[model samples]
Target: MTVIIFTVSVLCLLPQEVLARWACVRACPPSCTCTQEKSCSVLCDRSGLAELPKEFPCEASAINLDKNRLKFLSERAFGTLPSLKSLSLDHNNISFITPGAFKGLSNLVELKMAHNEYISYLHTRTFTGVKKLVHLDLSDCNLFSIPDRIFIEQTALKELLCFQNNFRRIPGAIRGMENLTHIYLERNKIEAVAYNSLLGLGSLKYLNLQENRINVIHEQAFQDLTRLENLYLNDNLLSDLPKLAFKGLSRLKMLNLGGNQLTNLSKTWFSDQVELEVLYLDRNQLLYIEEGTFENLTSLITLHLNSNNLTTLPFPVFQPIYFLGRLYLFRNPWECDCSLEWLKEWMENYKLVRDIPCASPSSVAGLDLGEVVFAKVNGTCVDPADLNLTTASSEITSTTENRFKSLIFTLIHPEFGDQMGNGTESLRNGTLIESEDGQLSAGVTGQRAWPSESLFCFIVMWLSLGLIGQSDLFFSLYCT
Candidate 1:
């Protein structure tokens, strides 16, 4: 009877053990650890995972397989994880992805495939079943090119990061992504942007093309990108731009053109950009800008013109840009002189002006223009015409005063006055003490009628008026 009880107990314990092992296998994947609280979240990251587990929990919502040794993604790589919304395969050794690799992952929303150095190409149908994917990151993948229409089925994709690649030019078919709102393509090898290159990207708002070799941008390059707001083109090889290069970007707000080779800007370049707010032109070779080049950009809030070869800008160039809130003019070879008087006043009144330290005319070099007095910069010819008039009048007055003094000295001297031959004499008060016939010099043969008497009064009036400027003040004080 005891042996019979032991056998029955053993059978019960064996079934319980088997059931416990089955439960453990169902709850967690062999190659990954599932969170107990969520029941469907798995973390297979950095586990030396060479490939997707033979079976993943059907209810898993997130799978993080980043920093793994996965090399290839064959068809049905994840085996139809219907509930998976986010999958991270970043920092993996993924080299090839079969066309149907992501089949049946219709619920997947975000996928990260960055830092996969061996990935150079992608098949056109690689994302065939991942129609609901919203954000895709394929940056730093050593990609040289991609098949056209590779992203056509990703209708819901909003943000795409494919920077730090070797693409020689933007794939023309990328313009078909009408649902995309942001695209990052910086640190690439794109050399030029052809007209209508971004034709169908109507919903795009931000684009980054910085750190590229973009040397040319054809007119209407952004033809249909009407809704684009922020554009970055800094750190490129661009030296010039077509007049209508930004023709259709009416809603653009911020533009970065720093670290380029631009030498000049045209007046109509910004004609259609009515909503531009910030502009950067620093680190260029700009020597001049056409007058009224920024007239249409009246809404500009910030402008950077630093680190260039600009010596001066025309007075009217900034007339229409009256709403500027921030201005940067540092590191340019500014020729501080009378011509900069208006600029100095503008900068002082704007209050948000940055370093405008003079870079030329050694007298004011390294000095902040906003602090220098306008009168000193303009020198004596603040108003050229007025200065010339004042100088001419001064010379005439000096000559007349000298002539009057000589006449008065001759008449007042005892020796010269009586020896006037016809006799002409005057006292300190112009009383005319002697005449031609010894009667106070009325009118004589060789003398004068007291030199018209008015001459003495004129001299006396001038002296009393005290109109002698500094240059003649000393002479008048002692002579008079």
Candidate 2:
């Protein structure tokens, strides 16, 4: 009797198992292609799907509905897909998502809804139940703001991509995201970085804010991002930065501040950036840099100060950066006078020092600054402290005829003449000229000016000085 009862129990369970297999096979929608290997995957991409398919494999782990016409996602749209780990709805017209649309996707790890231009707003509880989401992409969307509690349940989220959006400010919804490590918010319209903008995001390692319109950053704006490694704020409208703008980012490795309107730098801006490796300050309006401005950046390996209005830098400004391997000082008006004699000596030890052209003092104008400095030094290592601290005019006043010739050269040189003509035009029009690097220069009218009568005499004197042989040197200097 016991054997007969056991046999009957086995017969009843076998039919139920077969029915479960049949149900899995019959659940796949006709418009979608389903595969059931280790786990089910559905691909309904580009099938003109206006709405979510009514039936999906019960054990479906991934779904791709990209390039569809889905406009709205109703509540419980993906009902109870406990095994769903990934979903892609990119390039769709999804305008609205109900509060509980992802309610039953408890195991979802990645969700992509990028390029949905109509999603300008979201409900507070839009992501109510997808607690295990680790990566989310909302790039190229029309989101101007995000509800503060929209990501409240996404505790495991690690990376968030929201680039090419219409946000005017950093979203406050990312306040408590402790596990978030990377954030891509480039190409947005963010105006300012407010205080405590990243309050609880201590784990954030990379933050990108390039190509924005950020003009102000609060002192404590990045106090909570102590572990951040890379921070990009390039291509902004920042004219000045607070002394403590980057207060708590001690572990930061790279900081990009290129393409801005800064006229000067404060010594205290990088006081805490001990681990910084690369720094970009090119394409600004900096006229001079103080001695102690880079005192704390001992580990800096690369520095960019090109495309600025700098005429001279203070002595020993870069003596603190011991590990510097690459230094870019091109595209600036560097007056290679006695004050800059130290740069030539410094360049000898580092072959990575880029060629810099002198912009003034007609004798060396348009010549490689390194060559001029080498010629002036003449194989003698002059002590910087012992050198005379007189003006370039006083040093070259051995004869009255030479002084008159220098004055004529300054007035007739094409470089200075063109500069004066443009400056006059800018003064008349009251507009700044856009430079080749896309930064605004004060007096660059992009027009050439005719040389004065003194140019003929200056050219005759130059030809008589037997300096024609240096033409190859000048060409090679720039070409190299």
Candidate 3:
């Protein structure tokens, strides 16, 4: 009795499984391949499908309709596919999508409609019911702007790709998506970054705005993106920036500002970026960089300042980045002088120093800065401190000579000679007197004045002999 019951159970379940498989194969659309390895999958890629086929297997969980000629997505196009979790409509001629086009795809998690160039506009209700969508690709679609509230139902979306489009600004439709983590909007026409443009997206991590026309960034434009880790603004037209333009992004790891028109940098620009690891300022028109510009980037590992108009950089500008591993400073007209002596010392502790050729000072021209510093360290390069002191001493000597010449002139002037009757008395009294010509006549005002004509003559003779002996020294110090 037990054997018969076991055999009967096997007989009952075996045909049902076979029938289900047969039904799935029978329900598949013509010219489409169907598979049931784990869940039903329909692949109609490159089949030249003009429209979505009506007969899809009931158990279909994924459908790929790529490389089709479908120009329109009508209402309820894929009707009541409750089990549909993935759909692809890429590389199609899809130009129009009616309201309620995706009404019944409640369980859909991924939808791809990329490479459809004719889809320049979308209705507000185009994505009505796919609330569980986590990824969507609408890139290269020539979309200028997305209708507001088009993504209102996509509360679970995490990644959005809308790159290579005609957007002049960041779309307002993705403002409040709290779950979105990645956004690719590179190669667009975005001109400026307004303050409220990315207001409510608190969870965004990776944002790509490269190859755009972004010239202006309003102060605190990225204030709401506290969790953003990577941001790409390379290949733009930015020449200047507000002081607080990059505020509130403390967790950013990578920032690309290469290929722009920036002429200088401010120290406060990266004040809040303590966690930044990589920075790209290459291929810009940068002429000056303020000290401590990268001071707050304590975690920075790589930096790019190559291909700019920089002549020299203060060594202190890079002293704060302790963990810097790679630095690109090539293609710049670097003026290697004694002022960059500290750079040679700093480069010794790091192993990845690129060649920095000198552009000025013919003695060091065409040589790497490190080699020049090595060759000139032994009394060849003048210490800047000593140079400053020598300059100060020369100024003092010049002033002293000018004052002595004025005193001699006062002694010989005819108008002063007429006043000489009391000049001797005035000199004895240490008082300064003015001549008829309003010239300051040296008198005894407790200040140094010629005590006697004989003393002045003796001093002049002594200076004449001393100058003759030191003529070579004077020429070497001043003429060169």
| Clashing residue pair totals per candidate (backbone < 3 A) | 5, 0, 3
Which candidate do you rate higher for TM-score, 2 or 3?
Answer: 3
Better of 1 and 3 by TM-score: 3
Q: What are the per-residue Cα lDDT tens digits for candidate 1 across 1-480? A: 557445433433464455344332355667688864554688889898887776665567788999999999988777666778999999999999999999968799999999999999899999999999999999999899888788878888999999999999986657778888999999999999987568788999999999999999998888888899999999999999998888889999999999999999888788988999999999999998899899899789999999999988778887788668987888988877767878877776767775787875665678887765544323442433344456688775765566456445655553454444533222212222355465443233433445445354445545644454532543333323
lDDT of 2 by residue, 1-480 (tens): 557445433433465456355444456777888887777789899999898886556567899999999999999787666778999999999999988988878899999999999999889998888999999999999999898888988999999999999999999889979999999999999999999688999999999999999999988789999999999999999999998988888999999999999998888889889999999999988887777889999889999999999988766787798448898999998877766777776777667886788886666778876777433356664332223333343443333234235435444343454344433321222123444665433322353222332344344445443343342233223211
Which TM-score value belongs to model 2?
0.73
User: RMSD to native for every prediction?
Assistant: 11.6, 18.4, 15.1
TM-score of 1: 0.73
- Which structure is stronger by lDDT: 2 or 3? 3
Cα deviation of 132 in candidate 2 (Å)?
A: 0.9
Model 1 steric clash total = 5
Candidates in order have lDDT scores of 0.77, 0.77, 0.80
Q: How displaced is residue 290 in candidate 2, in Å?
A: 2.3
For each candidate, give its TM-score against the true structure: 0.73, 0.73, 0.75
Winning model by lDDT = 3
Candidate 1 regions with alpha-carbon error over 4 angstroms:
1-26, 36-39, 376-480
